[model samples]
Target: MLGIKNWINLNSSSVFFKGTRIATDAYGKDLLVSLYRKYINGYPKFFKMDPLSRLGFVACELLFNSEKVETLQTDNLNEDSCLILFNKSASLANDKIYNETIDNENYFPSPSVFVYTLPNIVTGEIAIKNKIYGETSFYVIDELDATTIFNVVSSSMSDTNNNRCICGWLECSNEDNFNAILLMIDKTSDTLFNIENLRNILNYK
Candidate 1:
């Protein structure tokens, strides 16, 4: 059975790992950027990514940078792992920004803004950062459903090529209203992957 070995959750005001709060924001600063600066010092391109991409990037970084994830790496190769992400907004926040660029004559459409109009870009950003040349997919659901998520991940893992997966939900509605819950799943743990577990993890704090 697939099991979650590690997980990270980032919301508008806090960051949590394994059900423990790691950081909280009281002044309402951009928590993503703040976490980037405090925990991650490198990756200059981080500043250029949209809110969704930044959220996913930071969560992935936090998950994979740990010693537990390091031990799972095989010579810097992560091709056996797949990324499955779902969201309700599906880049709508960035779409609004991109719309404004072309909707008015004063400002031309920005290529940088246009590039992140797709929800899958966040998955791409994670893939690029980790050098993971594996299957990646993003789904836009009407709401958060654990059964749907489990089914999708299960279907993807049916292929023998996919040994592990990074799966979760990421949503960025506005600059300050965002949340990401990324989980590293494989068949090496005692905790089984099920709808109940997924719900419990996602709802934890």
Candidate 2:
């Protein structure tokens, strides 16, 4: 059975971990950057990432760094420990900005903006930061589908060689609304991996 070893939920106004609110922003203004400075200390690269990447990066950092779970020895992670992420908007939030640069003669198309036009880039950012040389997949669904996510994680965990799985919903609308709930699952726990359980945990906030 796979169980949630650590989890983080970050929306516009607040950040939660393991059902506990760690920080709250009343105005939701610059909350991500505030959280990053307060908790992450420093990572200059974070400033250059698109909104989606910044959201995923901060959430993953908090989860893996949580004292509740055993510290992840990222260097020794198994190659099969995978990342499965789903989003409703894909990369439309950044795509729009990149698209604007295409036709404006004064502003040449930016390679930096072009690189984040794909949602999978967020997964790649996490993988590279953690040294996770494992399988990574990103899916865009019409809505938050817990059953599909459960099936994917179940299938990945079934592999004898695969041990850890990071699966969740990460969405950044064109309006800049951000919502992310990332969970780290592993076979070492007795908690059952099911749709209802996942929904309960994710909706806990």
Candidate 3:
């Protein structure tokens, strides 16, 4: 996904685990729980939903703060903006559950489990909420390569008219290990950059 510009990592274990040591270190646990509770509190079984739902909630919360976005507009999906999501773990939790259903012992399919089997769904959810409809896609790479990431983003932004993209890399190996980076870029500017310069800039992080 070559259209994001920020990183918001969350701890699923902290929210999922009830009263455990791992939950204690969640950097933004209370905030997450509070938001979720506020949005879907009345839905008795809302907490039973997937992690993507919670992530969507957080994304919406961040988007609500116009100060954080590069460009803010109304609820129009066909706008000149687009949202793309990239991740290594393509819904491993759903996959694991789906595999259990299809195993020789069970051998049954559950659409609920299959719905989140794609990593792109996370981006889709965000786009749906934000109404970004320029272009969207999901990529599964073995590792995060800055060059590759830059190339993909550069290619997508080649068309100046539709250069605004929200690119994101969200990796969630499990409930405890997850990372998300989002970047928003405008490709109309005639800016110049070199690999060495980028390397030097990124090395500081």
Compare the candidates by TM-score and give the number of the best one: 1
lDDT: which candidate is best?
Answer: 1
User: Per-residue error at 95 for model 2, in Å?
Assistant: 0.2
RMSD of every prediction? 1.7, 2.0, 6.6
Question: Could you tally the backbone clashes for each prediction?
Answer: 0, 0, 13
Ordered list by lDDT, greatest first: 1, 2, 3
Candidate 2, residue 100: how far the Cα is off, in Å: 0.6
lDDT of each: 0.84, 0.81, 0.53
lDDT of 1 by residue, 12-69 (tens): 8887888888755542237778888877878999999988898889888888875357
- The residue ranges of model 1 lying beyond 4 angstroms of the native Cα positions read 26-29, 71-73
TM-score of each: 0.94, 0.91, 0.67
Worst 10 residues of 1 by lDDT: 22-31
In the range 52-128, model 2's lDDT, one tens digit per residue, is 99888888888877854343554565486778899899999999989888875757898999999999999999888
Which regions in candidate 3 have their CA more than 4 angstroms from the true location? 1-49, 56-71, 75-78, 187-205
Candidate 2: give its CA RMSD in angstroms. Answer: 2.0
Q: Which residue window of length 10 is worst by lDDT in model 3?
A: 14-23
Give me the displacement of residue 69 in model 2, in angstroms.
5.3
